[model samples]
Structures are given as structure tokens and as C-alpha cells.
Target: MKSPENLLKSFFAERIKGLVQSDIRRMSRECERLGGINLGQGICDQPVPDSVKEAAKSAIDRDRSIYSKFEGIDPLRERIAAKMADYNGIRCDPDREVVVTVGSTGGFVAACLAFVEPGDEVILFSPFYGYHRNILSLCEATLRFVTLHPPNWSFDPADLERSFTEKTAAVIINTPSNPCGKVFSRQELILIASLCQKHGALAITDEIYEYILYGEHRHVSIGSLPGMEERTITLSGFSKTYNMTGWRLGYAVGAAPLMEKIGLLNDLLYICAPTPLQHAVMAAFDLPPSYYDQLCADYARKLEMTCAACDEAGIRPLLPQGAYYLLADISGLGLSDDKEAANFLLGRAGVASVPGTSFYADPEDGRQQVRLCFAKQDGDLEEACRRLRGIRTARP
Candidate 1:
């Protein structure tokens, strides 16, 4: 008779056979065990706005616990539509084109399920967010990668153009990218849009960090490009902008025809996002423009502090154009690879970071790097910075 482990392994589906928790979660677990500060996961340990919290409380008091329409509450959809037009420059009809989801992640899954099939080819940028890669894999889509070179994290246009083929069904774009905070420029989006149009491929974008920009970098939704309105599915959420990651509220916007299938998948999978939280996130849109300004300013300061600490510790910080993550080169640490460097940092400095291997397709590409999250509270981030700086002296 086979052992219990072998029996369970044989019963599991092929798609999920080799899947495990990501290195980000693994590092966070180890950090927790050691009582170390975790910069591994992008948890955004900041205070949620009081108005949003109060609105949730008010909704609960009023008994807003029933399942909502699978697409979401009308008021929230209307707000999302208004914001999409004003901020993202993509005009959409809330009633037909919007589908509120469990998170932007849910939107991505729905998009993948609705559009991708076995033997279809998808183009992805390397140093990608792990969820995007894994979800596409789970759907059995063949991925062709385009590398995003470091420093600015820009891709070669020739490489991107060559990635398209007759089998290309969709391309996944993550602007203000995680791990490496690269915001795709408008010119780049225009180029991508032209290719998608040429190849008859759809564009699926994740723009969850739309508001967390730095320097002169701006967020551009490819869906807003002249020819992309019908071909692009835009995904974003209140989680990053309002410091409400646990709320699990996000939405997708696209042409009505595409959204119909995505909405059905959402209905089949989740029924609806949490009812009361949907009501509460409506308050988030009411925040003034200055609120966004301050959010950027606060994150800019955090970025500066964290980058300085990494420099002091001899890890060369790759300055981000936007988003809250910083990827640093750990080659100077005299370790064999990113995993060893990460473990050394966690053990020596009591600060946890994700091994860079988590974000790349090839292990060698990330062998000398690690990613750090700076979206932390002021006191906690300061402590983390101090601990990181101590690594300079702690090294043998």
C-alpha cells in the first residue's frame, strides 16, 4: 500500500500539484516565528480612514449582511465608473461594464477563466507578480516572457513585439509593478496597444497601485488608449489606495460583451464581495484630492528612508518610480543567492524580506536580489530601518 502522502499527491489535480505558498508568505511566517519585523509581504500597515470604518459600522448596524447582486452595489459601481472616467480617462457604463470582485485578484482569475484555454499563448513581463504567473498556469495557458531590465525596469520594444504570435490570446500588464516598482509609461502602453490590435489579442491589466506614485511618474490605463477601450480589462481596488487590504474590495471594467462573461464567472465563484464592506468603500471615493497628495508624500518619505537604510547596509537599492516596494541587489552580502541573503538578513537583523527568486521565471535572474515593502507605520518602519542599518556592523 502507498503511504498517505503518496495517496494525497495522486489525488490532487495536475494544475495544483507543485503549487505551494509563495516565498513572500514563507518569509513572513519565519519572521513571525522569530518575532522579526516583516517587510516581506505588502500588507500596508497603515490606518484605514475613519470615515470608511464608520460607514462599515453604520451598515452593520442597519443589517446590511444579505448577498448583493453579483456585480456589486449600484452606488459603488457608479462611483467606480465616475472615477474611471475622471482619473483613468476610460469612460465606462457602470451598469454594463463593471463587475465588483473579491479583490483585483478575483478580477484577474475571472478574466483568466473567461478568456484563457489550454494551448492558448499569453505574454507576460518577467519579474512579475507571482499570482499572475500562477493563475495563468492554473488555466493552462502557455506563457511567453518579455524581460523588464532593471534600474528603470523598461522592456525592449523589439522583444515585446516578437512575443506576439498567432496563438497569443492575451497579455498581462502590471503597471506600478510589485517587487520591482516599474510604472509603465504612456508611450510604452501605446506600443503595447498597437501590438494587441495587430495580433487580435486582449489586454488584461492590474492597476491596484494606481495612486501610489512617486517623482514625476503617472499611472496610465492602457484601456484608456485610443484603440484599447474594447480590448482591455482594467482591474483595481480600494485595498491599496485606502489602506484597507483586508476589506477585499475590487472591481473590473471593460467593454460590456467581455464583462458579461466575467460577471458570470464572478457570480459562479464568489456570489458577491462582502456586502457591508462594499457600502463602506463608497466613502473612500469621497476623500478629497489632497488625501491622494498626502498619500503619495507619505509613501515618498518611507521610500527615501528605506532606500537609505539599504544603501547603508551595502544592498544597492533600485530606486522605484512608483509603488511601495523596493528591490535591492544582495550580491555584496557574500551569500550564494537571494534565499541565503534573505535568511541572513532575517536571522541577523530581525527584518524579513522576500527572496527575489519569487518574482522571476529563471532562478539566476533573481539570485542576487530581495524585495522589501515600505508600506509600514511610521514607528514600525523606523525600527525596521534601524535594524537593517545594524546589518552593516553585524556582518563578519
Candidate 2:
């Protein structure tokens, strides 16, 4: 008669049992309990556009709440296809190459299921969005890590070349990256594209932070590169761009054959994305280019404000080029461990942040860093900054 915990452990697979829950959520909960401001999660702390909301209401009123096609509602897919061509520079047939997903998270997982065979190798640049690593593990793919060193978070070409092998199946690229906010330059993308082509491998990119650029930094999709479109599966969503994280609307664009498999897997996993929300996302496509321009400008101001707060708090930060995250080096605080520094910040300064350890495959890689998200409302950013300033005087 084993205990219930032991019984559950016995029944669970190693992949499930071995999974380490990231400290981000735990710290988020602690922040809520202490009434502290949470800068840990990279969620936009703003209201979604009214037009998108009204569209959802309209659809529901019109009895469009029923199940949509597994690939997604037709109009939404058509819009996404047009968007891919216009923005990403990838020409895709909506009916054949687009598959709507629950979110980019769903798209990534579906792509993994569609392509990854057991024991196949998947390359991931470290300090990656943590979810991507977990999905690869579930697919039983062996991970090959190429670390993006900090300061610039750039990779050495030779180091990258050595990471691929005969078993290489795919590489996950998250440009406008998380935790560090390093936008992959076009030259870098070309370097990666060359390797993937040489290895006969695929590139599955997570471009969720695609539109959140800062000054002089432009996003270039690798899929748009010559000969790369057929080899790349682009996963992105409306979460960051339109403050629609809760809408759970995302899509995948790839070759027709790959998208067909992804659609079948979506059917098996989720059946379809939320029906009315799909209609709502279609409204987002109508927003003028000025809406995007203002979005970048607003976030740039927030980035500067937060960086100033970090300086006042004695946290040396790497200024971001695209996404709204700041990775502050915590070594100056005389703390060798990020988890300790994060807990101290939350407890003493009432500002919650994610330990950089949550982003890396090896805890040692991020032991002296902490990540704070700046995608907050104006008042929230001000409060968070005010609270963080107290760190300068607080006893370690």
C-alpha cells in the first residue's frame, strides 16, 4: 500500500515526472499574495483594443459560437496568409499553408508533434523561451544547445556550426528573444539559414515578440530568406501585438504538407481555436500601420523608464532592442544566485521579477541575472519603479 504520491509517481512517465516547474509562476503567486507588483511574466498589462472586443461580441450575437474548422475559421486564415506575405515577406496560400492554433504555444507544440520523431535532435539557442524546451522534451527529441552569450547575446558562427549533427531534425529560433530581448540580425539569420540548409534540417521559429521593436531595429523573418520559406515553420500570435494574450488566437505558416499535418494534430489536441475569438482576431488585421507605430513608440518609453529604474536600484541591465524585457546583472548586489536576488527584491522592494535561471538549460548560466518585464501600464510601471528604487538602501 504505497502513499497516493508514490502511486502517482509510479504511474507517471519520466518525462512528466522529471519536468521542473519554472519559478516564474511560483514568484508570480508570491507577488500576488504580498500585493507586490509582478514584472516576472511577459504579459502585456494593458487592455486589448476595443474594435477586437466588439467583433467578438458581434460574432457571439450572430450565433458564431459553434466549433470552427480545425485549421481555423476561413476568413482568419485568409487574413493571416495576407499578413504573412505583407509583413513577413513569405508568400503562402491561405487554404494550404495556414493553420490557426490555440496560441503560438499551441503552434509550437503542434509543429513538434508533426515533425519530431523519437530520438531526433532539435537545436535550441539557450536563454530560450522556457516553454519551447519543455515541448521538445515531450516530443522525445534530444536537445542540442548553442548558448547565446550575454552582453550582446550573440553566437559565434563556429560554435553554431558544431551544434548540428546527422540526427538534427529542426532548430527553434525565437527572434526578438525573451529574457534578453536580442533581435536576431539579418546576418545572424543568414548564418542560421545556411546551417539548416546544409544539415537538411527545418527551422521552427517563435516570433511571438515580432512587432515589438525599438529604434533602428527591424525584424527580418528567416522564413522570408531565399530558399528558406519551405524549410521554416513560422509560429506567431496576436498576444503581444494587440494585447490579446487571453484571446488564445495564433497560427502556423509553413509548406502545405507540413501545415496539413499540423492541422490534423490540432484536431487531435484542441479540435480548433476558440470560434468567436477567431472572428475577433480578424478585426485586429484592420488596424492601421499607425497603430503598430504607436505601439513601438509607447513601449520604447517604458523600456527607457524601466532601465532608469534599474540604474537607480544598482542593477546593471542590458538595454533591449525589441521586446519589453530587461535582463539585469545581479552580480553587483553581491548575490551569486538569481533566485536569492529575486526573492530579496520581492520581499524587500515589493517588486517581483523572474530569476534568469528559469530561462536557461543550466542554472549556472543565469545564476547572477534577473529578468523584469516592462510591458506594464503607465501607472504600474511608475509604481514598480518607485518600489525598485528602495533596493538601493535595503540590506542584502
Candidate 3:
């Protein structure tokens, strides 16, 4: 008899299997096994917000146990709409233009399938989030990479513009970006928006990190541009904003027709977001502005603390204007390969980090970089820093 694994489809989607199982998770698992402090996954090293926990409790108590309309209920949708209008400054009709999904991850995957036909090319700017590659693969779309050259993870506009083609179906922007913590400037966004509009393509903006920005930088949505809202799908979640990753609540906002189609797609894939979790999101949107102010303040403190350590290590980092992550160069330590350095730190120094090499399709693009999430308590950041400082390559 043939092996069970051999029974799977041949000529199967090559892209699906090509993805590395989020390197961050693998490192987190190793650290857990060894009882080391984990900073690999972007999950909060803090407590779940009391309001969200209470909302979840309230939902369960109210017997919110049945399936909901596949597009989500009116109250939660209205709350989401209001949140967008108030914060993102884009007014949307909740009933016509919104569909709640499992998380921003789901929203992105569904949007990718909704917008991309097989063989369509999508432009990705790296170090991009890890899951974008997975979504592109599952959508069966071809990827064109645009790299961000460091110490400042900024791209040359001419290089990025050259990557756009008539075959280009969509362009994605994530800011404050995932690994680099660089928030794109307004002029940069306008340039991208103009190109997409000129070419009749779509822009998908992942704003899941909206509230997590620090310093003088603010998170701006490409959909917020003069003529982009109709063609853009804004993806965001309660996961990062509320320390509610496990809550699995997120939303997609776009034009009514596009959203209607995505709603149908969601019906096929998930039926609707978890009914109880959707109910909980209503309370999330109503959080006072003070709550957000404090959240930003807390993250700013963490950013400075961690990057200061990187500075002390004799590596000057591109100070993050937003987002919770800071990517540091490993070359100063005489390390030539990030994967080798990451393994050494995890095994020898009792620290774990995502190698920047895993964030790019071609390892050569980011071989000398490492991504560290500063979304930790002070004690955790301090301990990790101390461990990282102890690296003495002369022994090796």
C-alpha cells in the first residue's frame, strides 16, 4: 500500500506547502519547553482587558449560544462602523459595507481569495508579516517582492513602482509594519494609492496595529485616501488592540458590493464570526479615549526600553515611530547569518527571536537581521536584553 501522505493531491498548490510554520511559534514552543521567557510571538505578555473579559462573561450569561446572520448582527456592526468613522475617519454603512470575520487573519485570507484570481500577481513589501505569504499561496496568487533596505527599513519608490504591473491585482500595506515597526509616511501612502488607482488595482490595508503605535507617528489607512476607500479593504482586530488575541474578533470594511461578495465567501468558510465574541466587540469600541492614550503610552515605554538595550549592544536601531516590534542588525556582532544567530541565542543565551530571514522568501534578502517584539512587560524586556548582551562571539 502507498503511504497516507502520498495520497494527498499531486500538482497541489506549491505555495501552500512552501510556507514555514510561523518561525515565531516554533521558537515560542522551544522556550516554553525550556521554561524561558518568550518574546517571539506578538501575543501580549500582559493581562486580558477586564472590560473584554466582562463582556465575554456577559455574552455567555445572556445565552448567546446560537448561530448568527453570516454578516454579523446590527449592534456589533454599528459599533465597528462608529469606531472606524471616529478613529479611521472613514464613514461606512455597517449593514451594507461591513462583515465580521474570525480575526484580521481571516479577513485577509478571505479578501485575498475574493480579490485575486489564480495566477494574478500581488506585490508584497518586506519584511512583511509572515501570514501574507500563506494567504497569497492559498489564494493561488503569484507574489512579487519589494524589499525594505535597513538600518532604516525604507524602500526606494522607483524600485517599488517598477514592481507594479498590468497583471498586478493588489498592493498590501501593513503599518506600523509587523517586523520593522516602520510606519509609512502620508506621501508614501499617497504615492502607492495613486499608482493603484492609475492601474485599476486594489489596495488592502492591514490596520490591526492601529492602536499599538508609539511616538509621534500615527497609523493611517490607505483607504482613508481621497479616492481609495471604495477599492480598499481595511483589516483590523481586537487581538492586538485589546490584548484579546484569543477572543478572535475582527472586521472587514470596504465598498458594499465587494463586502457583499466577501460576506458570501465568509458564509462558505466560517458561516459568521463566533456569535459571543461578536457581541463582546460592542463593548470594545466604546472604550474611552483615555484607555487608548494609556495603551499607547505603555507601548512607547516598552519601545524605548528595548531599543535602548539594542543601542547599548553597540547596534543603533531605526527608532520606531509606531508598532511594537524593532528589527535589529546582527552583523555588528560579527554574525553573518540571522538563522545561525537566532539558534545560538535560543540554545546558549536563553533568549528567542524571529530570524529576519524567515520573513523573506529569499534568505539572501534579510540574512543579517533579527526581529524582536517589544510587546512585553518591563521585567521580560529587561531580562531578554540582559541575556542578549551576554553574547560573546569570540568563544564560537
Candidate 4:
């Protein structure tokens, strides 16, 4: 008889072959292996708010560890609904239009599964968050990419319009985007919303970085646009805002009919978000606006520190407007590509960062850039900066 590994080759689905762990996670592991400062993944080293933690402890002590409703626990869902109305300029009925998910990542996957069919076309911006592409591919959807150019990372409205067709099912918008940190402007989102409307496409947005804005860069949900509320699925979570990534709590809001399907799919997949974590994040929303103000103030200082370090090393990073990421131009490093530069930095400089190719559809688009996260603790970030300053001299 054939061995189990050999027998599985014929049985594995084609989709399984294209799947791999996220490069960010891979780089984080490499950072660990080398005992280097990790700037590869956008994980917050900041502590979760004390109030939220206290709430979690209270819930656990009260034995609230049982399964929640398929949508979510009512208290958390109600708070999320109120938040949507107050902050996002949109209204949702918590019991009908919202469903808690494992994370925004899970929300995206559930939205894709709820709407896409095999051979359907999904529009994605180039330099997109990689997980979005992975979910779409699993749905067997044909991908149509619209390139976002460098520096500003903006595209012509006509170019966006041309990418959509009658067969288009969805378009993913990641604002305050990962890797690049380019927050989509309101005008740009309006343009995209118009195209999605014209094509009868679903606008599946990832607003996970909604709160981490800097210096006048605002986050506007495409779903908030006129006439778009019916066609958009908004996904966000407490992971970034509350520094509760491990809590894995997220939620999705959409039209009642579509959200009903997503709720059912959530039942089939994750069943519900964590009960204790849900209770914890209910307190997260109650945090004073001063808490978020301080968050931005803190990250801004970190961003400047990292940018200064890159300057000392003769690298130019695209300064971010809303997130804690820095995508630096590594073309001056005398290396062949971003991958080699990233490895060189890891091995020689003792700092880890993600290669830009991980974010683009065509590798060439990202060949000149590398992404680093500045969300580390201040001392770790300071150390990362110090190490990075020596990359040029250390690369013998």
C-alpha cells in the first residue's frame, strides 16, 4: 500500500495547493529564529486597556464562558451597533444586521463565502492585504486587480471603472492599509463606491485600522456613502483599536438579508466570537475618547523614531497617515530585490521586516519596497532603529 502522504497527492484539492501561511507570520518566525527585533507583523506590544481586562476577569468569574448566540451576545452586539451609528455614520440593527466573527479576517472570509460563487469575478486593489486574496481564491472567484501607483498609491477613476464588469461580485477596500499604510481618501472611496454600484458588486471593506489615524487622515466607510448601505459589508474588530489581537473578536454589518446568510455561515464555521472577550470589548467602547487620542499620540512618536532611523540608514519610507506601518524604499540598498534586502537586514542588522512582494499581485510592483511595523514597545522600537542604522556598514 502507498504511504499516507503519497496517497494524499491525488486527493488534495487544487485550492489547497495555492494556500500557504501568511508571509508576515513567516517573517515573525524568522525574527524569532534569529533572536532579532521583530518589525514584520503589526502586532501591538501595548497592553490591553485595564477596564477591558477587568471586564474579562469579571465575566469569567461569573461563568459566562458558554456559547453565545449565532450572531453574538446581545450586550456586545448592541454596543457594536451603537458604535456603528455614532462613529461610522451608519445604522445597523444588532439583532438582524450584525454577526460577531473570530476576527476581521474571519469576517472577510464569511462575507466572501456568503456572496461569491465559483467563476465569479472579484476586484482587488494591487498591494492589497494578502488574506483577502486567499479567501477569494478559496471561493474560486476570478480576481481582477486594479493597480494603485506608488508614492500616493492612487489610481485613475477610469482605471477603476474599467476593472469592473457585469460578472464582478465584490471589491475589497482596506483603508489605513497594511504593509503600505495608505488610507483611502473619501473622494477615492466615493469613486470606488460608484463603480461597485454601477457593477452591482458587493463592497467588502476591511476597516481594522479604523482608529489608528494620524494628522488629519480620516476613515470613511464606503457603506456610509449615499445609496451604498444596501450593497456594502463593513468588517471591523477590537484587535487593533483595543490591542486585543489574541482575543480574536470582530463583527460584520450589512444589509439584513445578506447579514442573515453571514450569520448562518458564522454558525457553521466559528459559531460565535469568544464569550468572555465579547464581554471585555463591551467595556472597550466605553473608554473615553482621550484613550484613543493618547493612542495616536503614542504611535506618532514611534513612527517618527523609526523614520529617523531609516533616514540614518539612507532609506526613504512612505510616511503613513493612519496606521503603524512603514513601507520603506530599499532600492538604494544595492540589493537585487526587496526579499534579499529583507534577509540582509535580518541577518546583518538583527531586524526583521516583511518583503513588499507579499502585498502585490505582480511581484515587480513590490520589488523595491519592504514593510516594517512600528507598533512595538518603545524600547524594542528604539533597539530596532539602532540596529537598522548599521545595515549599510554591516553588509560586508
Per-model clash counts, in order, read: 0, 0, 0, 0
Q: Can you tell me which runs of candidate 3 are displaced by over 4 Å? A: 1-15, 314-316, 392-395
Looking at candidate 2, the ten consecutive residues that score lowest on lDDT are: 14-23
lDDT of 4 by residue, 1-396 (tens): 989898988698988788888778988899899899999988888999999999999999999898999899998889999999988998999889999999988788899999999999999988888888888999999999988887877887888888899999999898888867878999999888888878889999999998888888988999899989999999999899988888899999999999999999998999888887887789998899999889999999999999999987877888877788988998778789988988988998889999999999998988988999999988999999999987768755
Best by TM-score, which number? 1
Q: What is the lDDT of candidate 3?
A: 0.82
**Model 1: per-residue Cα lDDT over 243-278, one tens digit each:** 988889999999999999999999999999999999
Task: Rate residue 59 of model 1 by lDDT.
Answer: 93
C-alpha TM-scores of all predictions: 0.99, 0.98, 0.94, 0.97
lDDT of each: 0.94, 0.91, 0.82, 0.89
Off by over 4 Å in 4: 1-6
lDDT per residue as tens, model 2, 79-132 = 999999999999999999999999999999999998999899999998888889
A best-first ranking of the candidates according to their lDDT comes to 1, 2, 4, 3
Which rank order by TM-score, best down to worst?
1, 2, 4, 3
**Candidate 2 TM-score, true structure as reference:** 0.98
Model 1 scores a TM of 0.99
Instruction: Give each prediction's root-mean-square deviation over alpha carbons.
Output: 0.7, 1.0, 2.1, 1.4
